[model samples]
Target chain A: MSAFDWLPELLERFKADYVLIHEDAAVTTVGRARVLELDAEDWGRAAGVAAKFNLRWAGGWADQLTDQLGGDKLQINACLLHQGDVLLLRTRVPVTTPVLPSHTLHYPGADRMERHTQDMYGVVFSDHPDPRRWARHHAWGENEYPLRAEFPRMGTRGDMPARTDDNYRFLQAQGAGLYEIPVGPVHAGIIEPGHFRFTAVGEQVLNLEQRLGYVHKGIEKIAVGRDAVGAARLAGRVSGDSTVAFTWAACMAMEQAAGVEVPLRANYLRAIMAERERVANHLGDIGAICNDVGFAFAFYQFSRLREDWQRLSREVFGHRLLMDCVVPGGVARDIDAAAVAQLRAAFAPMKREMRELMPILYDNPSLEDRLITTGFLSESLARLLGATGYVGKASNCDLDARRDLAYSPYDRFKIKVHVFQDGDVLARMRVRADEILISLDLIDELLAGLPNGDVRAEWPMPAAGSEGLGIVEGWRGETLVYVRFAEDGKIARLFARDPSWFTWPALEQLIHGNIVPDFPVCNKSVNGSYSGHDL
Target chain B: MLRLFNKIRKIGVVTEPVMPGRDPAFEEIGEQLHARVGELFSGSLAIREVDAGSCNGCELEVHALNNPYYGIERFGVHFVASPRHADMLLVTGPVSKHMEAALKRTYDATPDPKLVLAMGDCGADGGEFGCSYASCGGVSKVIPVDGVVRGCPPTPLELMKAILALIEKRQGG
Candidate 1:
């Protein structure tokens, strides 16, 4: 028996409602009972049963739960943890007021995530501290939950009141010599929209609070009625930077729920695409980080390098970003022999050049001066806040979804994770650069051992009550997606969790004591995706 | 002398003319940029990137271009972080309603004679999100675009090709 076989006993310890337990095909629970049967009501009740275990049963039953679990279960949601396991929760209320308890009180990581759910889905969390609207930063008015079923798709609320003027409350910066510097909804560089409110004493930063959602695309609401293909398209666009990860996670969840097996070749190609995404991002970030410290040569060289890298992507993936390349069952297209040959020919010189440039970057005194101590995040804080990607790895969060949650080929390959104790901008930069090198190596391995098989498999219709979970270590961090299908194989409900939702809050913490000017560098060091979170 | 010392000591990529769309006192800036652009054609590059306002589609191949095995950086191009440091801007997506000012600011902050390449269909013509209420459409609406890397977030190689073209253009090739 698997370690989870004793779950019923663990639930008994908590006095959770033993609604029903399915004993036949993998033991399952519903409401307060544990039984062995395939029934929709049992699944629905299992959701309610989570409440007895401290989970709030607020929203409607869907394929997965990415929203708030309000009412009494809020505290439970915060603190619950399972080893080598995944949880998919969905709620449905006939009344307009759907209540799910706050989980932030139990799980500190869920603090910001729940607030976002409350704002987007209109789920009310009673007594949840910092109940300030998270995603609706004046983009929507009071009670205007964008993700709700009733919100009209194409309607204009002319002259929506400014969020800062009325809704978004900034902590007062008081005392003589302490002042506030409000920078960007509009910034000076090619970046996303996020307003930073800095409270500073001269050059040193005292506190920095970020107000994002300026680019909210209402992606979750649009996914409500979408088919699997439609939803896959939307998922890839959730954060343009990490499209490969998001789409892969979404497809993984769907295929699992539908009991469809993706071909081995497709999985290999997916890994290749994901590694490419990782390389491109790491290259740009390392270059940008150096430039922030007044190192222009590394910045320009890296930028030029990144552009060439992307140009070659067109030849292989068809789209530079490889958007929509991943779909349910398999990938949209295949890589040709010429493309493979081009890649093999190209990698050698690129690696050599980076090697030559590395010493120049490390040997430079000023480059080290700027990156070494700026924007330090203690390893402990990194863990607590759940920072992912290079940010967390640099800070000693020794977790990569490729290894931690072994799926297929990842289990076969040994993934090297570069970690640092310093957890500063420099550490993050080092980790990114190292990871880029490693990803290149892995890509070579994957290409050399290219498998021959069908890219896709026939998708089976999921039983009405079937549900599954998918968690991927996106270039940013761990991305979670859950899918629940109706009896007819259509989507019943879907939810996606981006790593940025966790890392953005960490930004506020890392900026403490950093100089006001250094804030941009620190932010660039982390480089969280706003679109990924807003969706 | 110290100011000059500070400028000369910096070690990321430095192209000719520290500021694009602006004039410089030293003729060396132009000459420096020409030499660097020439090097890019001869060598491979790796890029560190930042997204200003994009539908995110541009970000797709911006990444896909380097997937293992493709190794676009092997071609002598790379994405860098700081504006004071980068050789070019591979901006994807149309500038959005909220990102207009940020887009221009990023452009202005970039060092001189820098190539501002617009990637993807949206970066060129706003794509699907261009006409939407949230988007300002093409980034060129806010900043000068040197190279238009077309396609709906053009294929990685297409983006790579466009950047290669930018390097050649800057070198006056």
Candidate 2:
């Protein structure tokens, strides 16, 4: 049976008083998902019911309600997934006493997100497992919540010394041979900064704790008053590698809120861009993962191919990473017949080269030794954490927004979602490799049947309080963007939830029992986006 | 291994010669640097990169430097793991407040005669996330930058020219 048919019956069975079962008319003119709003008191119970019904926790966020709206309160938003249908659950707490029951008790993946909401909006999640700050690292004063309407965009300049986060209390292990190995907020490589505290006995890691938010640049705060197009540009940079995905999602959200209809050609072009991005990232990652395992040959070959791929992207799209390419109502650029032919011609050779490299990676005993069974995450833990994308797919969670939650151009194509039962470094690598092949095929199909027409639409200003959600499958995984328009045609709030939110916490879980030296490859396998997480 | 060798033979050497023709201003600076330093800085420059708070777009271009296309190692410029062993520091992002102290510490660790190059528009002028509650503005706000490469993400060629300019400045001083 379809998810929509059985969801309401299941909710009724679990004693859920559904306040409203409304269509998502605010975002799309057609094909809106069923948005279920529930009572605040049954929030935690609803979470338990959903978990029991086998729904995955997609993501959660908080928005501060202004007093001008006649209520000084904080609205909490949580999303759950059962097959293709998305169920959005919201609850509110008074600004004076902003506290709600935590969902982490039912959905373990909600832990970090709850803490993040608590840190940014000062809404306390009572009975939260670990209450210590998640995203707030003394970037602002203890009492100052940055997401509040009263908080200024340009924060106060302080004379406080650097290294203010020296006193964060990490969970300690108490044994004779136990010691902690603290790594970066500043790493050795050309990567974003994040602190990892590994409590270990000798080389075997006993426990792993990550302290991110070192790269938080007030993205959500700066997006407060931007126009739909302007806010999309900001969203594009949420994670540079996932620029196309984030921008497309943001634009989709904005278009939905404004009730704009993107042309068929524009949707097709978006698919091509998104697929190219997927291939590029997968190539780079396959190479990087090999490099981490001390295999330089695969690294060099893959890097060369990735470089060629990006150069082609620059020639076709305006940017190498396709930054700021997707604007509200459509895309910024369109491909002609010649560009389409060039793209179609380039795929076969690239695939040939990739096929040539695959055997070496699969047969190399040393590489296999490093990757197989290393940093293994069981399927149970993966589901509990709601880890989507390749990380979840590697662990056998078969939910791809492209296939399961198909939308627009993607719905027209037959997508091959790759999933592997063994949740190891090897499994993740294989998933990426399979995805690269699949994305190449998708690109060929998309370009071969390129749609005709204008690429953009005239987007009318959305009414104030109009809200919409945009969901897309990024290279990393599923990306969700929620956009609400203000009265003056400015953005009320734009929350872009990257897939890294669910996967970063999984990195901590998988690192257990693995040796310290295996940390690099294990970490690279997941390759969580620090900027996406921080934002 | 035999298959790999055959594939390698078929591909041959794909590295292209340095064009040095994209930006005239950068080309002129490159010429000046070449005249000033000659082979002195060639084959000896070690760089350490720190991402203050960039979107990883700059980091992707930075990684491309080591690829076969740019092959920065041919010019003796290689990325080092530690700041202590480096002759220059490549900083990206619009220095976030939380990372202010860490960037300062990385700079201090890089030893004397260290050159810092701020990359991308964000590193130079805090691209989108400007001076805010969480950000302290560009790399210059947290540490002194000797040169700046301005692009949303400067192409690898632009980055190469910027490196050459830094070498010239060091030698001229």
Candidate 3:
């Protein structure tokens, strides 16, 4: 039986009657996700049903409806996933009194998202557990909502005072033994900045509150008025490590919105790029995690391997990171038979080296001692936070978008989704290792059976007000994008929700019992994208 | 432990030479800087990196300098945790408004005789996320920069060369 087979019946049983809007249903169907429009009053009730059905709260974003219909209504979108199917729940609230019932009471994952929406669009989610400003910093005033239509893309300059971050009220732990350890908005390492306040007693963390809008580059605001291709470029930079994934997701959204079909060969190439990106990141991450645990040998070896892997990517795809490779309607570059042969030849040596190194890492007593049971995030906590990707997979929440959703060329490949119930640092490491091996095999298969045809298709402009959703299993996890085009063939509103949104909160949960020293290893194990989350 | 030794034996030496050959222009510039500044940095250069608002692309490339191939530490270059210990500030990203004050504070905290190297196009001049309501643009807007390395994300070799140039600048050359 399918996982979402009971979704229709469950929706019908909801107290609030929802009207399914199918105006752009064709575009929505491109992602194989169902879209439903409901009354604002029923939003919370519908969310409750989703939670009751054990659906994963994917992400939520707010889109201003001023361009489509010159009014004060703001369209709020929430995505829920059960097995393979994505159920997008949307509701509209007036701009004057932009208040809606919060879904955080049912699904705690919606807390940060609702706060983000509040910051960006001024849509208040009444009864949200933590109603703190999420994505907003001192850059924009409380009165100004950047994502709203009236707000200029460049924004009102110098309207607010500098350095307003000092006033943020971190949840304090008041006790004799309790003391707060504030770590960065500027960190020691060569990393993106995000402040972490750990309320700890005797080296055990009581509460960990994160302040992460330091890298917010106004991505959503800049995406507006950009053409489909321009938007894809913007999306590629949303998270640098997940460039191919973000670009692919953005392109997929744009193509779906414009009613364009990418060629089969292009789809296959995209998979190859995505897999390469995955391998590159996993190798780096595995090394970084080991480094955090004082395993320098593995760090050196894995970093070398990753460097060699990225060099091959540069040779084949032209960019070291494969940025701008996935464009609207198709890919920006294509590989020849020689390049294919090169990739196939390269994998065997890599696989052999990886196999040789795995035992050394797994068998190392000191490393295992550091990693094994450290940073334990219970399965219940992982589920509650709506964690996906390696973090979720480690906690036994087995959902892989590539295997479950199986979009295009991925449907042809037999993908293995690895799950470990340990919910610890070692489990996360094991997942990354297993994924690396699986991804290598998949890439080999993809290249071996690559279809021969044209790579690109001409994109036709769809009517204004058309919307499309693109979901891709990025290296980190599920990357969901929603795109709506304007009358001038520009993007009206584009929201790219990275998997870090779900996983970052999981980091805070996992670090509770562990000592302060273990925090780095635990953080590396999860490796949440700060820029991606901030955007 | 025996298996670990065997594995190490199989992998062999992966480290490469730091400077295989220097670019002619770089060599000339190096000499000019060396002549201009006489051993301002006699021993080692310590760096502190700040991400203003990058996509983390440039940071990744910067990190590659520590890997086996580059081994920047061998060249008397190291990343320090505190700005006070740092001889250079390797700043990345288009400076975001939120990070503007933080970047300034970091720059101010760094001791004098500090060389500020803005890495990546975003650091030199706001690449994609330019001057806007949310961003103040490049590193120079928030803090004065001595050198700029250009690329969407400048390659590791490019970064090494830029670092070398900064080293010369620090030496009063």
Candidate 4:
């Protein structure tokens, strides 16, 4: 079904076009993710080939190769999703003339990822469309690259603060009755900061442009000296709401790098906590979306449910958001009988309230009037944008890491991924509602079959130059983490790709032709993470 | 409409008992933040929340303050959209350098005789992510802070306690 039989042979033929320096597809404990090296000249062509093979573009990042030799080389890496596996393409370029062909021409989602790599590592994409500064809003000087090994972690800043929000150009659309509405970096409500510039004719938006990186707290730069546990804590902070998944991803990367087999019980507990997180966020989002449409009752009810659910998480796992719950070797705490019983009993009331409210949510004609056709993201567009979570599901892009790339815990579980065709606000909300029930069921089954064994294994410090990648389905969408260890097993570099990276661009596309006021509910339905995206 | 009413009645009176009460787990929140910004926001406080650059953890708890369980609105604390209408600014950070001018503009916009209370450990002293090229490190570095409610993010109850504590300290209690 995959039709990847031609992959190996096709790769072999590429040796004639450009030099094939190195190639290996390592089957690590995590899974098989094929890695290959290509000459820097044909970097864009490789992306085209991957696109031709129908591989989903995962993410793109760069590693500054500070070899023992005097050669100053930077290795550019791009990951593509291939049926429960990943094909990583790496190409090397000298730091002086760090330019490669663009991948954005093939996949629209690669636009920001490539820009981020450029902003951080000073890698240049020659044919990049709309090449603006991303993640570099006066964070450093124009020539200074923070991700470079020589650059200070605190940045090259002095006593006074540099002006950060000026001198940037935004695209202009001139027409009759066209006016721009600028929102955020600092928003009206309790949310993270990111600037959105919109050009609209009266109420209908003509174009939407976003300038983010206001929250780029130097996550990658700061992770330089931290060990595995410390790295996990920092990863947890990458996105506050999806702390469990981020922490798990970081820890899983470390575990795989160290070649340690996590205890079966720990993996089970990890799945349970991840599901709980999914449920909590979904409940909060559904309520928020309803509230956005002026349905105050649903917001109040859902808030109560979420608050209650999170309190249990804080009680059982020692933090409301479940940060630091998943450690390098295993989970921080084990579930005692009382905690397990309480958790088992917690779902019934939640499910009952949800059952009563969902029909009301779907049946309301007034709410439906606003939701049924607003913010329609077509199926082909979702795939092009590499959208995931409810945003993708609503558009009938039925891809879920839990099912498609099934790992431990999820490997045994039967995952029901719901997809819809309308691609409107209503479809997105319905997907969230459906997914909450599915996650609840998953958590229920996991708790019922709680494994009895040691919850942790010894995680020895991995050798220098060890690297691994970890991925999990975060509440927002697919969360990917890449970590490389340095001397004394300290983190040399870490790149985290939040689902928001894909969904943010998708937001820009979906907002086209929608009224200005409907933006909030549509945005709530998608709920992209700002802190996660900024980092 | 009748069906909606029936559903509402069936799930009746779900508003949480006001205030963030003590939980079974975690240490009791006994620490009271000290601040003296004079007697302002006496019977009511209009808060303008500025995220200079937070992990959004503090914002989550701040939002929880409005939830039925910890309904601070019942106690006369409300979140205002515009800074000019607010009596206090609840800012969260490691204040990113990119946000400095915006935060300054927000602070300048707020009418005088206002209190600025930094939220979270990051706001208190930059937490784990200290001063960097990207970050100015701590909210006080960017704007004057009257008091702080500390935690990676303080719970909704803890935030409520801190807000009340700020009022008490300011009113010379």
Report, for candidate 2, the interface RMSD.
Answer: 1.4
- What's each prediction's clash count? 122, 0, 5, 0
Tens-digit per-residue lDDT, A298-345, candidate 1: 666676667667667757887667789899998888787777788767
- Candidate 2 clashes between residue pairs 3 or more apart in a chain or in different chains: none
Candidate 3's C-alpha runs over 4 A off are A1-4, A15-30, A67-70, A159-161, B18-39, B169-173
lDDT tens string, model 3, B77-148? Answer: 779999989888999988888888899899999998788999998898888877778877788988899999
Worst 10 residues of 1 chain A by lDDT: A72-81
Q: Summarize candidate 3's per-residue lDDT along A396-470 as a digit string, tens digits.
A: 988888988889899998899999999999999999999999999999999999999989898787669888889
* All candidates: CA RMSD (Å): 9.1, 2.8, 2.8, 3.1
- The residue-level lDDT of candidate 4 at A320 comes to 88
> Which regions of candidate 1 are displaced past 4 Å?
A1-13, A16-83, A88-95, A155-167, A459-467, A486-492, B1-53, B57-150, B154-173
Cα deviation of B11 in candidate 1 (Å)?
14
Predicted structure 2: lDDT? 0.86
Per-residue lDDT over A245-290 for candidate 4, one digit per residue giving the tens place of the 0 to 100 score: 8998888888878888999999999999999999988989988998
* C-alpha lDDT score of every prediction, in listed order: 0.65, 0.86, 0.86, 0.84
